[model samples]
Target: MNLEVLSQHMNLISLVVLAVVVAIGFIKKINIGFFSIGAAFILGLAGQMSAKDISKGFSSSMFVTLVGVTFFFGMASQNGTLDLFSKKIVALVGKRTYLIPILMFALSAFISAIGPGHIAAGILMTTFAVYLAFELDINPMATALYAKLGANAGCASTLSMTGILAKNLSEPLGYTGFGTHLFLTTLLSGFVFTLILYIYYKGYKVKGDNPLKLSDIPAFNRDQKITVAAIVIMVVACIGFKLDTGLFAFVAAAVLILLGCADEKKAIKSIPWGTLMLICGVGVLVNVIDKLGGITLVSDFLSSHMNQSTAAPIMAATSGILSWVSSTTGVVMPTLYPICDNIVKTFGSNVSYVELISAVTATSFAAAISPLSTGGAIIMSSYSAAKETTTDEMNKMFKTLFLLSVMNVVINVIMAALGVFNLGHLFY
Candidate 1:
């Protein structure tokens, strides 16, 4: 075959194999990364690529960033620091159970924005929020959803894991200085949906909790104090001075371990190794696909179906659908972000790349509440742990959570359509 024909064949081969890999991930028993590596090898062979060509797709930078940040926060999470901090925040509303949901939203947002980002915050906050739901006699799902939303809202900050990853993915695509813009848009979108959830769950009616005394809550111990300080410093360093996030996290985590405040083994184990692997592995596949023209296909498909006015929201809607079964940071962002440049080209000069970026990001995270996603899975497991449940109840909860996820995604898409995500245009 000629070079052009071989290139087309390689693109088709990589795209089809990627589809199979992603479908296999949905099987629940398989990790997609393994298949992705093998698929990349196949593409490498087909395209006359060297082994280095296949392996180069592995993003060591992204891996280190994910590992360092998660390990650092993992130490804090395992040390009871975050838990105690959560309780202290919950104590703010005192018997005003109606306000607990909003409080949880803000608490999660603050925790996430400060450093750990949504993945860590969602796991920690969703569990806490669900427990509070039962304790405060409120809607468990609603509370969990609010906390999840809050986690997502604050996760896009420059200091946080997702924010860093978003920048890493977007910057190479020529979308520089959009991190702060993306952060603001995601934060605002998060609050808008959180308020919708609060009203829907009737936050004004949540009652029947006795006051939690501030004195009854223990003050931060030395280790917890150190950990909190490290987080704050990391935030300032990354945002104000523009230090590397992953390296700073490693320094903070090492200090915590050296001080005997956090267990090294436990913290290491707490990191989501599987998720990290999936991220890097799928990145390999996506990189290969991009090299082979799969991204061109995506751009063509989008251009065929969408216009300038609808382009941003269309991307939002597509991202929302894919995010139900994919990682927003890992799979969705890396794979789809490259299409932004092409999107701008196809839709017209007036298309705001920042808005498109914001819409896709905000909408993808909107679907994080799906039971298939980590946030929803945590809510499910935490609820089951705290209460006696039957199979039917679990099934119902899953469906209800999925529906709520749809609601959240729909709101994000509508906001994107209405130019709400255009808020980022100011900063851009």
Candidate 2:
């Protein structure tokens, strides 16, 4: 075979390997990242890539960010700071059971907007949100959905990883001020989803006569107070001062540990290493795919099949589908953003670059509620660990979460097709 033919075959094989990695991870209950790394090794050899070339795919920055944020939050969890905050918030809502979901949503969104991003915020909020649902007789599925959506709402904040990635990706295409646009689009989508969940769950009907007084809620102890102060400092430094989020998070974690606010060993163990590995491994494979011409093959196919009018929704749907089972930042955006960029170039004035990017971003995040995604898995695990959850209830919640995930994908696609989040005018 000629060199060109061999190259083409390698590209096709890489694509197949990528799909198989996802499939085996889903079906065999294996860590998708582990398989992704294995696939990368095979594809690198097929493409005649050097070991160093393949290793370059691992994103040290992203890995550090994940570790620092998750470790800090984990220490907060260990020290009961998150619990204290949750209890106080619930007490403030006192008897207005309907407000529980709204409050949780707001809190989660605020935390995400400040800097931890959606995954960390979702993990923190889903735990307490589901617990509150059980205590308040609210639908755990609805609560979980609200928590995850709320996190996504603020995920596009300028300080968050999602926002940073979107901004960096958009600027090269001559689309400026995309970070704010992405944030607005994601926030609007999240609000719409939250409203749908609220209505579906009959939140308006919930009421209780008992309203807890402020005094009844426990005050923060010395350790909790220090933890809270550390978090506040992290937010101010990372957001207001534009400090490195990962570095700031690590500093805060260290302070907490040294101050005896959190146990050293447990806090160290609490970092979500598996999630980090999954993201980094997928990143390596995606880089390999790009190197092998797999991305070009896929982008060309999309361009051939889609015009300006259909491209936004098609790409949105594609992102939502893939992100449900893979890392949104690592797999979905890295792979699809280039395709969207190609579409914009192909259609020229016919396409709005900002709108296309926003749609893709929103769609990718909306699917984070799927059980396979980190946020959804956290919710499911939290619910299962709850003492109030019976086996039957757990099964029912699983079904509900699955259905909700599907609904979110459909809603995002429709929203993108209708240009509901067309915020290009806001930036331009």
TM-score of each: 0.95, 0.88
lDDT of each: 0.84, 0.78
lDDT of 2 by residue, 221-295 (tens): 898999889988987897678787788888988898888898878877877677668767887897898788887
- What value does the lDDT take at residue 118 in candidate 1? 90
Model 1, backbone clash pairs (residues 3+ apart or across chains), number: 0
Candidate 1 lDDT over 110-187, as tens digits, reads 999877789889888888888878876778888888888899999998777778777777767777888888888989
- RMSD of every prediction: 1.9, 2.9
Model 2 clash pairs are: none
Model 1 RMSD to the real structure? 1.9
Window of ten residues with lowest summed lDDT in model 1: 205-214
Model 1 CA lDDT for position 351:
89
Error of 1 at 158 (Å): 1.7
* Candidate 2 Cα misplacement greater than 4 A, ranges: 2-4, 164-177, 209-213, 349-354, 372-374, 387-396
